[model samples]
Target: MIERILEQSKALIHVLSADRRTRHLVLTWQDTEVLESIHKTLHPLQEFTDALSGEEYVSISYLKPVLHLLKTKTLAEDPVDTDLTKSIKSRVIGYLQDKYNDPITQELLDIASFLDPRFKTNYIGKENIPAVKARMKAKMEEGTRKEKRSRVRDTEFNSLT
Candidate 1:
């Protein structure tokens, strides 16, 4: 919405400024500057939000990589950013870091992404890879044992019948 308005700003500003009743609604230069800064700061986040919202494509494993991209590329402060844009970027980066900084949460993400074939170990921290691998091994072995026990039980029941 803001993008569209900004795109047609010249025409819209002329129309709004020309009308007595709507003249009061015309955005001042300062207001447009602030709005433009805000729009620029937040525009990159929309793609991340939309990608994460999808059930078919998104998975828990995507969160860590997406956050990494957000901090390193999408939300990084640019040299040309206005003060307001820089501040907004900083707060968003800070929020994402704090939100995912918990030890358990980090481990969960590491394990999930590591288990995923498409990303296995690509995004996992070097320090975390060993632990995540160990957990996956344990789980796979546990599943194998359970399967063996179930097969044995079925065989015993079939023999009795």
Candidate 2:
């Protein structure tokens, strides 16, 4: 039954990609389902990687399990086949975009691209995020300074009067 599903999936994926005029797009329903399952199974790994890396809110360790899981599933032609790193990366980016409201960073995007074509052109660049962070930090500091100054002024006024 599983084998049947995998075969159909490969055919369907090939058909769909071909239909879309994508000559090499390949992923059948079984492969798609398996990839989804792999994604689901790797949630814990991502959490672990995020916690370990101090980038808990923005980590991609969840991908490892998916890749590993793909090893077990059979491909259309091969007994088992896994997507290239680029495909994995794009999926990760897509996952993050769908799951989180945060803007995708260039560093992460680059890492994804480096990892797989799935990440190709997914983000703009790293040069912009830092300026935004810096500006936000500066605004916060400025607000704090103003609050402290107001409190000091109040204290001075009370002491003098």
Candidate 3:
């Protein structure tokens, strides 16, 4: 579970571009503080940037204790802070207020409702199977069409090279 969470976090972080000047990921100052709290769990990981005159790049290494600390941060466990959790939950809900009328979001919510363990899966299994399969098949066909188009485009593009 820890490894899964770690991989998820790592994948997200891998996409974070480093600021050449600050050597820090371009997170907001507030997020930087949150990250620092999280970062302190492990051996100190230092970030460098171009601004650090003689430093070629920032190097941050993940050590074992930090990995262990993050392992315990799994979502399956109740969040340690009730106020923080409720506050964050409400903030996220507020963002969805405008999107409540969207059909796509509705459909996603329907799928999520089924996946949520609180609900029985019977309705999803019997009533939604066709719709789910239709969506899946449509997505599969679209992917195939995209691959074919890309192959043809690549051939055309390469012939001109």
Candidate 1 per-residue C-alpha lDDT over 25-127 given as tens digits, one digit per residue, 9 for 90 to 100: 8878998998899899888789878878887874788888998898888888789989999999999999988999999999999988887788888898998
Residue ranges of candidate 2 with Cα displaced over 4 Å: 1-80, 83-93, 101-125
Model 2 alpha-carbon miss at residue 8, Å = 29
lDDT of 2 by residue, 45-95 (tens): 465455546653433533433333333332112323245433554465556
Q: Which residue pairs in candidate 1 have backbone atoms (N, alpha carbon, C) closer than 3 angstroms, thus clashing?
A: none
How far residue 139's Cα lies from its native spot in candidate 3, in Å, is 1.1
Best candidate, lDDT: 1
Supply the TM-score for candidate 3: 0.30
Residues 1-161 of candidate 3: C-alpha lDDT, one tens digit per residue: 33333435555455654435544654455654454434333212222122222345321121112222323342113445344444443453354355453666545544544444454243343666568657767888999999999999999999999
Error of 1 at 129 (Å): 1.1
TM-score order of candidates, top first? 1, 2, 3
lDDT of 3 at 86: 40
* lDDT to native, each model: 0.89, 0.50, 0.45
**TM-scores, each model vs. reference:** 0.92, 0.31, 0.30
Tell me the alpha-carbon RMSD of every candidate.
1.5, 13.9, 17.6
Off by over 4 Å in 3: 1-106, 110-125
* Ranked candidates, highest lDDT first: 1, 2, 3
- Model 1's alpha-carbon lDDT is 0.89
Best by the TM-score measure: 1
Q: Could you tell me the TM-score of candidate 1?
A: 0.92
